[model samples]
Target: AQSVTQLDSQVPVFEEAPVELRCNYSSSVSVYLFWYVQYPNQGLQLLLKYLSGSTLVKGINGFEAEFNKSQTSFHLRKPSVHISDTAEYFCAVSDQYGGATNKLIFGTGTLLAVQP
Candidate 1:
């Protein structure tokens, strides 16, 4: 089985400050990594993903993440943040070869609090 770990449950930063949310995973087979954001009372939106080529991946809303196979980590970063950026971020993973039923395993989630 595969699992994702979000080191921090919450990240608090003032408006315009940079932030990084850490995520790590453990899996025996190949896996695809993803970052999704959920605003209050809304569904999750795909932030970034690591499918195949290119170690670095960029996503919507000025978010980016680097896939490190050695460490099995895909940490999300934002150069600057806005109050609107405050939301719950979840790191998810799915087996690349585990067929269609391979559901995405998500992390506990990190709540990013951007105070104005």
Candidate 2:
């Protein structure tokens, strides 16, 4: 089993400023980590993921995250922000080999409110 926890419920940042959204997880077995973003009233989009090699994974909108296995964390970071980046971000964990019935366990979600 696996579960995720977002350290912050919301993050406020000024335009062009850097932001980091922290995520932590617990699992008895190996799991895959994922980050997703959701615009207002929109479906979730895959921001990034860590399924195999490369602890540092980059996604769209210049978003990136480092998967730390020792600490069981996969924190999302963006060097610059824009008003359009203001959206809800989610961290998820799923069993690495629990295919067919593998379900994603998501965090409460963090709202990134980018200010002008």
What lDDT does candidate 2 reach at residue 80?
89
- The candidate 2 region of ten consecutive residues with least summed lDDT is 95-104
RMSD of every prediction: 0.8, 0.8
lDDT of 1 at 114: 97
lDDT of each: 0.96, 0.94
Please give me the total number of clashing residue pairs in predicted model 2: 0
Candidate 1's displacement at residue 34, Å, is 0.5
Show model 1 residue runs off by greater than 4 Å: none
Which digits, one per residue and each the tens of the lDDT, describe model 2 over residues 70-112? Answer: 9999999999899999999999999888869868999999999
Residue-level lDDT of model 1, residues 1-116, one tens digit each, is: 99999999999999999999999999999899999999999999999999999999999999999999999999999999999999999999998987769589999999999999
lDDT of 1 at 80: 96
lDDT of candidate 2 at residue 48, scale 0 to 100: 88
Model 2: how far residue 116 lies from native, Å: 0.8
Stretches of model 2 off by over 4 angstroms after superposition: none
